[model samples]
Target: MTNYRNETDWERADRNIGELLQELRIAIPGVQVLFAFLLAVPFQQRFAQVTDFQQSVYFATLLLAAASTMLLILPTAFHRLTFRKQQKERMLKLSNRSTIAGLLCLSLALIGATVLVTDFLYGSEATAVVGGASAMAFMVLWLVIPLRARRLG
Candidate 1:
């Protein structure tokens, strides 16, 4: 509804895809590193010393990272499948949704990782503070700010 450029729908879709892919390029590396770290965690000797709660958090965080990775990569796969099929608009819609969901998952994974580390290094008290702060920061920075800006614009 908000036209930033005087371009046709197809042109807009193409540009949106380009911008989305660029954003994904920025996000994918962090997700990969987090996922890799999660994957290698259980193999570490100290992993055996983790509390059951930590283990549960680790599993959830790993799954979140994996889901983020898949959702982030899905746009490219969708693009490939729809390539030259005159479905740019549809692709753009799916890509936009997938990217948003991917970012949400990534934020939750990062928060979980923070909580796990804080709990492991300190205790439940410190973990509670850090985890709450981390979640609030992500929510404000990633979700609230963007939505507020969008509404204002």
Candidate 2:
């Protein structure tokens, strides 16, 4: 039993950070691709023909993807800045906070993408329907399910 637990707070913190980094690795690539797509949209020929609402959605999606990219990359910066220090516990705590923030940004990015895609295809009503559904699904999977599992398990 004693062997199953961390010997020190630092070890526990390191383990926590390791778990967070693994999760972020999974999230970062998708956001990076989304951000890249958003970055390229303005240069497309059809961009100028989009409606005002769609243009707004495009800008918002770009910003959300940018924010998510930053959030997802925060752990690496945090670790680099704190290298050779004895602050693993603090770093891990900060990284955990950053991960939560990143996930929120990711959720927003997904919602924005859904809005942009649906708007491009079927207009505002379709945008609302798809975006709302995607956001709800994200909330349930990223938040509710995790909380329930943590509490029950």
Candidate 3:
């Protein structure tokens, strides 16, 4: 009970939902871009040049992107269907989990796509370096900072 939010249950739920929706808004655009890019890759001429492993990575990344997009979108659908159902608490919790799952899929998708391209253009060594850096970037920006804030706030 850290008094971080001095709101009543309903007020907190409303605020949490608002914050979650805002987070989704910020996340959705980038996910959409990644999703669209992945969708278009198979149509590109260079797509045929990728190795078997690269193709596998491509397919996995594409599926992850699609899943991420759906998970991100599910929150809104959940909200709409349950808006007046007096289940804000349950809805918020589930939506929060969905958002986290969406982010995890999006992170892996981004790393996989980046590694695939790097492996194609550079090699496996460069792909490893780039993949590590990209994962660290997400781990820091998306995860560490929030955790630090939670601890310090």
Best model per lDDT: 1
Model 3 vs. true fold: TM: 0.91
The residue-level lDDT of candidate 2 at 137 comes to 96
Model 1, poorest ten-residue lDDT window?
1-10
lDDT digits (tens) for residues 27-95 of candidate 2: 999998888888998999988889988888888878888888887788799889989887777777787
| TM, every model | 0.96, 0.92, 0.91
Question: In candidate 2, which residue pairs get closer than 3 Å at backbone N, Cα or C atoms, i.e. clash?
Answer: none
Task: Say which prediction, candidate 2 or candidate 3, comes out ahead on TM-score.
Answer: 2
State which candidate has the highest TM-score: 1
For candidate 2, report its TM-score.
Answer: 0.92
For model 3, the stretches where C-alpha displacement exceeds 4 angstroms are 1-6
Per-residue lDDT tens digits for candidate 3, residues 10-117, read 888888889998999899999999999999999999888989999999999999999999999998888798878998999888898999999999999999999999
Spell out the clash pairs found in candidate 3: none
lDDT of 3 at 47: 89
